[model samples]
Target: MNTLFTVSVRRISHVCTLKPYKETKWLMPYGNPTGIYVYNCVANQRVPVILSDPHIATWYSCGPTVYDSAHIGHASCYVKLDIIQRILKSFFNVNLVTAMGITDIDDKIIKRGLETNTHFTNIAKQYESEFWLDMNSLNIEKPLIITRVSEQIDCIASFVKKLIDSELAYVSKTGSVYFDTSKFPSYGKLSRMQDEGEPSDEEKKNKMDFAVWKGHKPGEPYWDVPWGSGRPGWHIECSAMVSKVFGSQLDFHAGGIDLRFPHHENEEAQSCAYHNSRQWANYWIHVGHLQVKGDTKMSKSLKNTISIPELLKTYSADTFRMACLTSNYRYSMEYTDAAMENAEEVLNKFKFFLKDAIVYINNNTATHPCQYKDSILKELQKVQDGNIEALKTDFDTATCINNMLNLISSTNKIIKNDSSGYYPVTVTLIVEYITGVLTKFGLKLQDGSQENIFSDMLIDTLVEFRHTVRLNALSKKDKELLNACDIVRDKMKSIKVQINDSNKTPSWVLIK
Candidate 1:
């Protein structure tokens, strides 16, 4: 019975919208294109992504309160979403319009402001700037719309008035306005919390009724509203801003897994009531927590959260991203030093594999074309199909990442043992394809160590240092010494110096 109802809700959700995706030249559907699928938490299953228009979709992500620096928890959610967003736009050919709210007027910000002797907006601005830096560092795409709660007070107030006028909400004697949850029969549908009929406070008609507008109080901000001077409720902030921007139905609503309860449930309820529709958002995509110390979630109140800047200080952005994608987006990921170290090693494997392939391509002038083009093509096909298949199963990046590692290992076997000469450029095709996929996954690739700890000239120094040492090691025939030189060469990188040595040496002069 529960499954039936859930299925019905999902079907009706898409009905609220109009058209769907296509196979070819968007306007006129041609062949059968692969329909995108996402795990809709509300439906408790994987469902086809739908939009009113086949070419465009709408998404609204619940962003941070901007009271402090963003942490790994935040990175885990936004970065994963960014990867999915890029795939949808580039591969799926969907023009996604995304919006994220900056919760500048939350109680957390107010408390932080008072504690730091700063105004709430000032605190919001400071951290918001830092938040942008973190997002850029992670290569998160900027949302098409950025709505701030402080700037949307008028719109929120207008939404509240409409709800009150429609009897879906009521203004309390304290001048606060609350959404009457009793009027919305499906209030607990999303969260699955048992319905309650407990007695309410003097201000609420029902205990479950949540505030839509908070009355004016000392030491807090206020805005003029029909129900006296008050501020928008935390739950109403998203509904109002999203509705003002996208109107009635949305293709997707996303946030962290923790938001599924009161925050998201409340937001969904009010949006449904205000829009006078059974379903306001088609899909609820909630990302899992980034935990630490065995299921202890990283959070501000927990004091165990690792900030983005701090994590970036030790690891590259790509490494951190790999750590987050190590598990399914729906599963909680533990952040430990070992986990980060593993991610770094995996990243090194990818870079070293590409570097070796490129070097082979450059040095094959005297050799005949690779004897096994068909076998090489088979491997390339596996990578291409594996990547697409992985993404198809609800953005199963964990599977995709694993497949990539396995492919690298398999491809290495051909490179190492195969004695037959092949066109060096054959492997170059594989390198380019892998790099393209990496870009789609929102990763920045560079030769050598991804670290920027040393200057560009230093890469030249290391490469030259190793090259000068190479001849001595060959005479000595020291396996360990040769391996160490290989390591140094792989770690050396300089963009300014155009290095095309048949022996993989930097030939151009240093810019400085």
Candidate 2:
């Protein structure tokens, strides 16, 4: 087996290994190269990504700053990334080790603390807690590692010192450190921006160069380092955390489109300069910005930002997730009431179809040597292959969803026109396929309600008792027993349970 070396900054320890890529059946031909191809921002073209190790893929996403409550714009980015990760796991059968860094000590955090008259550390903790709560409600998977800037201060300072020693960075008169962009010829390659024409602030020597460490301020939080008593810059925090957790290179780096310039560009330059590698991350994925209904961008300054909690009060998490998936990840999406309402309607239709399918399977018996069994099985296989192919091409979830809808339509038509009801195998296959896809998208048919084993046993007892009473009523022609059966039916109906009496063995289904 091949082995890859790992790098540590200062105090943190991380293990890294390089493994050979394993071929899989899902590989397809597209984007001028084979396998899964995604648009690389730096390459300015669609490039194929062949993982070094098929079993494990590394991913890093720029997490929230934790200074303020996360809004819908933030939700759009995280939800999209979550969906992409889900597809990579389920569709591609790859194990993902994802990391997201939290900016706990930042300029914004200090500003917010002064405004609220609270300690910056307290403010950061409070908002971080709130951010995790929102992520839980949205059903997002927690990252394998969450690195905080405050925790990685020592590592960050060590990284800056290495850059300065290599002549890639310089210390200013204020005892702060800044990266010398001129030293790194490919500094603007990721962002594709030219060098800055003029310096806006007189603090640094060049306009394009950015601060890796800031000087100590009177009231702001500071950490003791070789350079001075100041905190790490925003870009340096991410670079340090990535180096400590993922080592010199990552399989994928993702963030919103806004980070393409300045933030990500700077991160790429710094990491490459420190590691002496030409590339920092193999593939760069960015989700498009989210806009309000009036074509206005969602920003705190505009006072039009919608908080995640506020939106959750009006819409289900699944609904919001569906709305985000309907659009292409690379294209900007407009968040409107109508879009969410439409998504809710689509979700309801799926639930209704699944409910009916489940009821049909339970109520009817499987026919031996069924007529439509072969054809139905073949059709399901065809749909499954189509869905996988669509996903292989840049994760076109919209197309995958459309294919699901088409399958549902076809299933409905087949059931309506057939003289005989669906066979047991047919119903089982259709239900399993639909449910599997829904699970991949992080969706569920039921409205947060589940029947426990005890509840199931009780329902079975009631059904058996009702069946016995009905049989006795038939034998003796007793009116009281008939009334008791009707009462059971009424109660079941009130609880949204539908019972089928047409078959010899009664089976019930719960409708949402």
Candidate 3:
């Protein structure tokens, strides 16, 4: 069966307990309220999602501006979004085509270029490359289409011209193009902005929308448009790119919570004004921001921001990912060095448990292994069965991972208590369960394209390496040979360091 169809069926099965839903169709996690679940939607500040059309799943996420290194805050949202897409494929088996637009042309790029006396395009490209490197290091699934703002200038110019013709936008005397927010009645619907009693002079008489094109400015990159050579504003680029790629309306729209204010609201306003409808997106998904420890928000200006590259130098990408997933998707993640270390400790423990399980299976392979009676397997199966329900309820990843961790810990406890010489061949199931959990969380236990090795191989590698070290120390009377052996050990250590640094590894038999 197709992967998408299989996952769709699982998602359908999860919600069948409520009202009878057709299995052939898939529902998105949005829509108007119905019955008791109406409040559940409000809790997340969205209506309950009943995907009447699973095929309605066109997804979009806001990408980086490419002016600087990506911060951990950005990484959190990107990784979480990637996991959402991956888990849908894994558990719900939904085939989703995800896209994000990179803002290679922006004010920030130009400003940084001016400060450094370099070309804006070069600066943007450099940062964009670094951003992708960081994302790859974290094993973030790349967006299917990474549309660049520089490449999409033609589309953006055409969009602005259409909006001008529709009387939804206009050019100022300075060639600055702005969206006519007043033309769109539901301008702040998505963010639900509160309106004061009466509009002030600027608010009432002026074009209320954000700038679509910021006419030519000093030392900034300029593009040819009907309104003259100028750059597009922060908000309008997304609207133009999304409209060109996914049509006028998208199935789902997402961004960091901070973008929900002026950026997304303005995009919604501009898009709807041009399209002439209240529907800009079928579902709006906003990820909460990551905060600095004990702070309300993380900001580069405040010097509280931690870049992905800097953090990766200290902890493995999986550990960082674990920290990201520990909090609810809708809640803020407060990152600190201590938090990451704690997550690494837990991950190391999980790895050790897996090692033990492997050892048990190897010890038990002697018997015919008829009826497998692993308590760990039973717990894992139960968790897998119920995880779908947790996912369907607004993608409750925190709960889902919690259930998985409980199973891992419980299984470890069971293995610890078992005194029987029958170490149980059912450990294979336990290893697989751990793999499933790790994979769903965007962590790959097995190295890519390489066949997995037996657990004994891992033990043997460490043991052999140790044995070689002792033998060389005792047998080699020459200090120079001892130094050479030490160099080899150092080289292996360096390889381990590099592997850990890049968050990459090939299929392996043993650590040696």
lDDT tens per residue, model 2, 100-187: 9999999899999999999999999999999999998888888999999988888999999999999999988887888988777667
Task: Report the C-alpha displacement of residue 64, candidate 1, in angstroms.
Answer: 0.7
- For model 2, the superposed segments whose C-alpha errors exceed 4 Å read 1-34, 365-369, 373-375, 417-421, 451-512
**How much is the lDDT of residue 276 in candidate 1?**
80
For all predicted structures, in order, the TM-scores are: 0.81, 0.80, 0.76
Model 1, 80-161: lDDT tens digits are 8898888888667788999999899888899999999999989999999999999998889999999999998889989999
RMSD of each: 10.2, 10.8, 13.2
Compute the lDDT of residue 378 as modeled in candidate 1: 76
Model 2 scores a TM of 0.80
Off by over 4 Å in 1: 1-34, 447-512
Q: Give the winner by lDDT: 2 or 3.
A: 2
What ranges in model 3 sit over 4 Å off? 1-56, 194-204, 364-370, 374-378, 418-425, 446-512
On TM-score, the candidate that comes out on top is 1
Which 10 consecutive positions of candidate 3 have the poorest summed lDDT?
34-43
- Show how many residue pairs clash in every candidate, following the order shown: 4, 1, 8
Q: Report the poorest 10 consecutive residues by lDDT, candidate 2.
A: 18-27
**1 or 3, which is superior by TM-score?**
1
Report lDDT (CA) for all predictions.
0.74, 0.76, 0.66
